[model samples]
Target chain A: MFTPLTVALAVAALALAVWCGWAAYRDQPTKDWHFIGMAVVSVLALAQLAVGIVRLAGGEDAAEGTVIFVAYLAAVAACVPVVGLISLTERTKWGSLTVAAGAVVLAVLQARLHEIWGGGGGA
Target chain B: MAPETPPREPRDPGGGPSDSDATARRASNAPARSAGIGKGPGTLLVTLYGIFTVGAASRSAVQLATRFDEAPLAYLLSAAAALVYAFITLSLVRGGERARRAALGCCCVELLGVLTVGTWTLVEPSAFPDATVWSDYGMGYLFIPVILPVTGLLWLRRSRSHGGPAAVGD
Candidate 1:
């Protein structure tokens, strides 16, 4: 994994999570701005995914097992979209909270992914 | 979806309703009338549980498939934790009186499992060559395994007080 990309993804995810959490605290449902934030984060994750796949195809291996690494990659890639769908199903402040939680999870996963790739970062 | 309507209180046959009685009825019915376990805040809870179910199940499956000989006990414990999470998630989404009871039972079991396994892992590090979901009180997963059941129990208790028509209040 690219360290800079990973860091960027984690930072973006955390920023979005905090924003969503603030909105939820104010008793607001998920708004267009939240989706936009998610889109930005998703784009970063997709880039990371593409980079990871290319590296794997080029015969690079993660320090951790390839299977679990790939699984985490796919999970990170899918996280935002899945949470977006869940938010749509709920049209309350809780829905925003759900998205916030998802973002936080994604951020944590990104950190784990970095460590799994032998980046030596703390989780 | 439209918000759930409160059920009308059964009228007294012999006399007109007093103001205090109507107030009492409304108060008692308020929370019960809100939503089933599958809706509102319950939706968010179920979503979190669902994520853990998938995460724990996949992790154990991978560990068992690849390195079972290394840490069979820990891997098996992880699998069991996954099962409990799955059951609780299902019950929460099912969201009837029966489902609530089932979830309550599972939550109790989950709390016991986490406590027992967490303590055991701490007391005997050699026993767990690898960490299970409950190891160190779920430190690996932000201690969610330890916290989830406590939150679940509280929610279940609140739901019970709101006692649906099919629910037998404790």
Candidate 2:
């Protein structure tokens, strides 16, 4: 319902995508900056999960298939945590990069989800 | 001081074609157990491939199950493409002599699939209604399917030497 959460998630995801691309372009290990960017993405993703569920429960229909919308929400929601866990096990810069990149994918998909709910394509 | 990636040892991608440092880095994707399944680029590639496999498979299934009669050729091609994605994912995660060969073979097939299917889709529009993984050179996926094999072939070629038992799946 509220776009604040969606906007936040998309923004964070976009920022991180940019950051990660820069890091990769420089051929550098993902660093503290990467983690910070990822943290923001993760928080926003969680918010999306919360808001999406509420939107769905409020009798709103997903113009792009409710099942797919829910699936995308769940995917966007759990992606950060799942990748975070995996990254923790690695303890390498690549681990951070992995998590960061995962968030970028999540954000991209979340935008798509919004389009689905709005009955439109990407902005 | 500016951050820098560690100096990478020059390597190979196993039994495939082409050559490049970028492709060689895929060789670092150690077997699932030793390096863990999520270790290097291979892990990421495998995960991405797995997602694609799922996406393609579900798409085909949904299309076929709901409206098979509408576009049988397109749906069938979707199923086939999904199978190829699954096959490539399996071979990568499996990582053994057999797996390597399987991956190599699949990569080759994937290339041919995209090429033939791509050309055919344009030549015979009547055949495909919507789209398939290999349709019009994977236009839907931005040709990632087409590019994947070339990368795969190069990676497999580079991995051939150090690719012995270390390539075995966990």
- Taken in order, the candidates have interface RMSDs of 12.7, 9.0
Chain A TM-score compared with the true chain A, each model in order: 0.95, 0.75
User: Native-contact fraction for each model?
Assistant: 0.31, 0.09
Put down candidate 1 lDDT per residue, A1-123, tens digits, no spaces: 788899899999999999989977776778898999999999998998899999989998887878888899999999988888888876666677889999999999988898888746532
Candidate 2 local lDDT, B130-155, one digit each (tens):
77788879886767788877877766
Task: List where candidate 2 sits over 4 angstroms from the true fold.
Answer: A1-4, A26-33, A82-101, A121-123, B1-39, B161-170
Candidate 1's C-alpha runs over 4 A off are: A119-123, B1-35, B164-170
lDDT of 2 by residue, A1-123 (tens): 456677777777777767765654444445666667667777777777777778788888788777777778877877766666655543444444566567667766766787888877432
The C-alpha local distance difference test score for the whole of candidate 2 amounts to 0.66
Best by TM-score: 1
- Tens-digit lDDT string for candidate 1 (B31-73): 5542366555666788889999989999999999999999999
Query: For model 1, which pairs clash?
Result: none
